[model samples]
Target: KLVVAVQGTRKQHVDTVGPKVDRQKKSPVCSYNEWDPLDEVIVGRPDNACVPSLTPEVKAISSPQQWEFFRKFGGQFFPQEHLKKAVSQIEEMCNVLRHEGVTVRRPDIVDWSKAYETPDFKSKGMYAAMPRDILIVIGEEIIEAPMAWRSRFFEYRAYRSLMKEYFQAGAKWTTAPKPLMSDELYDQNYPVESVEHRYKLSSEGRYVTTEFEPCFDAADFMRCGKDIFAQQSQVTNLFGIEWMARHLGPDYKIHLLQFKDPNAMHIDGTFNVVGPGLVIVNPARPCLQSEMFKKAGWKLVEAPKPMVPDDHPLWMTSKWLSMNVLMLDEQRVMVCKHETPTIKMFESLGIKAIPVDIRFANSIGGGFHCWTTDVRRRGVLESYF
Candidate 1:
């Protein structure tokens, strides 16, 4: 007969064979904001990354000039030579993190070229190279996002091992309800020809993603202690933001921010909250709610123009990635080696810049903030706004 210990009327099971457990043990996942002292983080991999198909969602966010690249290379690996350089650059980044005394973990490398079919749609996988787009750490819990892209539906599989480890170590794990990427979930007639038209539509809250089901990319959200700033983008709908608000309960306040971007997708590149009261605002894509931050006594600094050459291929993003930096702590920032103006800006703010060259990696769609998710940061929950 198996011996089981039950507590009260709830019928909670106590492990009889294992050592005595401490119920008050702190969870291994505890990151309230972006600038906390870094402890452990999950860095993404560039292995076997595949280009997503040129679907409506992709078309909505991409510039008109980059469509040809997507049309030619969709459903295939990014140029092998480019990927090779990205891999080397990422390895150096991991090394830099290790040198900083931070524990770095990586996702399992899976073949993203494999195709799969669901009841709603069929598509191949994209890279597991951006952990920040799929996983969010809010206090002691790790929430897996239900990404909007069809190519990203199964991206969570690469992070399951890490999730299990964190859960075993006493972390609360939650996966938001996944959205079915059916025809109804997307606007089949979303205007993609003109940037001006897209800007008008985005301002009116008409995005490529419909409200058929809650869908969001984790990158669309910027966490700041008790308050979280979110955006309704081509990949993040109003319904998704509402779902997150309700799911997080009244303890956390979710602020919906709008910007002047025509191809808005991720907020990190546009309005990254680097500290409790400091934010790096993109000059090109100005936030409409700038006055709110100002009234709250927050300093919104405009980012200097990016130095990425016009010939460089940024397939899925713009040059504003220069602003998407990761904060190791309130005093240190991981920034692009080539972005000299950004480095100077960080220095002017009294933040040390740990420059790493990820120019090739940036081609895939992210920067330091997008490539890694801070798993355990030394901080507590507090209201900054």
Candidate 2:
């Protein structure tokens, strides 16, 4: 009787272990810092890019000279010839990444000319050519930013498929609460006509985006293991930073940094954390907390003058995009082909510079770092600051 009972129990235990279940579950989204050995990445697409309307928020980031372009082409497609060259350039970038043995993923080609009406405002869509501006991966969670610009509100749609795929493969997916984007969200009278006034406003901790709601671009945050640095820019507000701090919980520390930038929109272009304790800082926009970095024993390298000519049309960014580079690992960096000084600087630091010509793509906005978001890097979370 005892032998028969024991056999029956063993058989029941074996039956409970279903055949469809696997014991090992691996997550597809994992990255802790910028300089780890990259496993996978999401590269943005420049197809059907649109110029945002010359709203107060847009006016805050771009210079007075570029406002004419926005006013003329707002809610309209970018020049097809320029976009064609950009498309071709980005394709080569993907090819280079793939050749380097990194898995390259592209967002869906989206139509940025479509007009949509939200309850608070009506606007056209913007292209998904800057994934770093919309998505950030912390630990295992990939959070989508509630973009401040109305034209970029629907940019997440282009990356929804990739997000779903990662979720199915055991990755944490979270999207921040979208703002109403009502008139109250913006400070219409925010001064942007003069650089001196904007500088004064920036020094006074004021921006075009009000504290009425939480709004941010993912590019505002620079990750370095447990210590993540963020800046309050025209697109990032205090409310948004607080929300991120709370959302991240106690596992991570959010450090608020202030720069002397009058038109700061993304941290990557201004203060890029390239490695564990190395940073490439923009001399044009000095960080007020630079002493903190110096005390922490972090090496801060000032980027050289950009080689982009005066005639090069940078509609949405400064020539400082030359410093905005992507690190394949701690030993390898992807820089602009024409930026000889930057290439020499990287080589001096014992890093290989993989040069590629994306001047046309730069006209749209962003460099290698802004063009791609690292999805999975082979590294664990470790304190670097």
Candidate 3:
């Protein structure tokens, strides 16, 4: 049985769709939906499914040493309010899975309390898998690349925890090692060419996809982006991306996005084939041409446009990062609210679109799709006449 569990903000829902609300104000939350259609066919493990042995178990001990350890590590990265809310939701999601007979587990502070209590707690935060705490369909292993300062501390850790947990659940996981950049460029810290996204295996897992070459410089990024100070490299870093891809699965296909004429923001930003012959891409900024999508037996749909020119009032208000989508099937997808128009347009073509609420994180640059990666997908079974 396929299941999907969602975390929603319903009170905000009414305000977003209210007739009097500003289109721009409501735009960010417009696609929010509690029940997504993709769940009917593709299970959302992070939201529901659980693995038993992979679950974290805690025991109470009278020893002061143990008590001290628990007190120290029990809550590190999050403030009380945030931690409470996060834990509650995680528990609820787990319970839902338990009700459905799925084995599930959550990471705990039992073994690493001492490591977490230090000032370097932030570095050790990798163990916790903060904001994106749970790992699902991808298996018991966690995977990640470098991120910004604030995000690096806890979010990366959360990503790792999920990856580790996924591997524990019997799924393969992998990633590209951090590249060694020149010191002169180190202060700028922008990658000229690299894999921006990756895929881990799940169920008959066979292939992996990543962003193409012709690396972007500051000019390719938003004008307001800090990395705008650098230059782009023509040579592609296909090997680094290929390294991670091959480590995780068998066969590989590089879905290279054409540069020069832009359309999609990044690889994950658009060009998701949720179902065979059903593709979601930004007609303006695409990984490849519409012909590619059509040739792959995919039906194309334009993705949401990103608002840029950082200084603009609406810049932050508009959705720019297209990386926030999860594929439920080749035809069905779970997308962020900002992608509502894209979803509606897709449904117009007889494609089923399911929206997931992720407004808070949308402000942070990524949405639900960016937060999670599907490790497993149902294989296309060709029927004989």
Highest lDDT against the true fold, candidate? 1
Predicted candidate 1 versus true structure: per-residue lDDT over 96-145, tens digit per residue: 99999899999999999999999999999999999999999999899999
Error of 1 at 27 (Å): 1.1
Q: lDDT of all the models against the reference?
A: 0.92, 0.91, 0.32
- In angstroms, the error of model 3 at 24 is 53
Per-residue lDDT of candidate 3, residues 1-385 (tens digit): 3233322322332323223323343111111111122221112222211111100111110112333433443434323343344445445433543453334433333222223232322223222322221222222223343222211223333244545544444444544343322121111222212222111110111112122211121111111001110111121133433443454354223233343221122243434434434445655443434675466455566665653334422111134444345544435554544556666765776656555444433432244444433333323222110
- Please give, for residues 1-385, the per-residue lDDT of candidate 2 as tens digits: 1222222145332434222223377678899989999989999999999988999889999998998999999999889899999999999999999999899999998888989998899999979999999999999899999889999888999999999888767788999999889999899999887999999998998999999999999999999999999999999999999999999999999999999989989999999998989999999999999999999999999998899999988999999999999999999999999999999999998999999989899998899999999999999999999
**Local distance difference test, candidate 1:** 0.92
Error of 3 at 142 (Å): 6.6
lDDT of 1 at 345: 95
Deviation in angstroms for 343 in model 2? 0.4
RMSD values, in order shown? 3.5, 6.2, 18.8
- True-vs-predicted CA distance for residue 330, candidate 3, Å: 4.6
Sorting all predicted structures by lDDT, with the top scorer first, yields 1, 2, 3
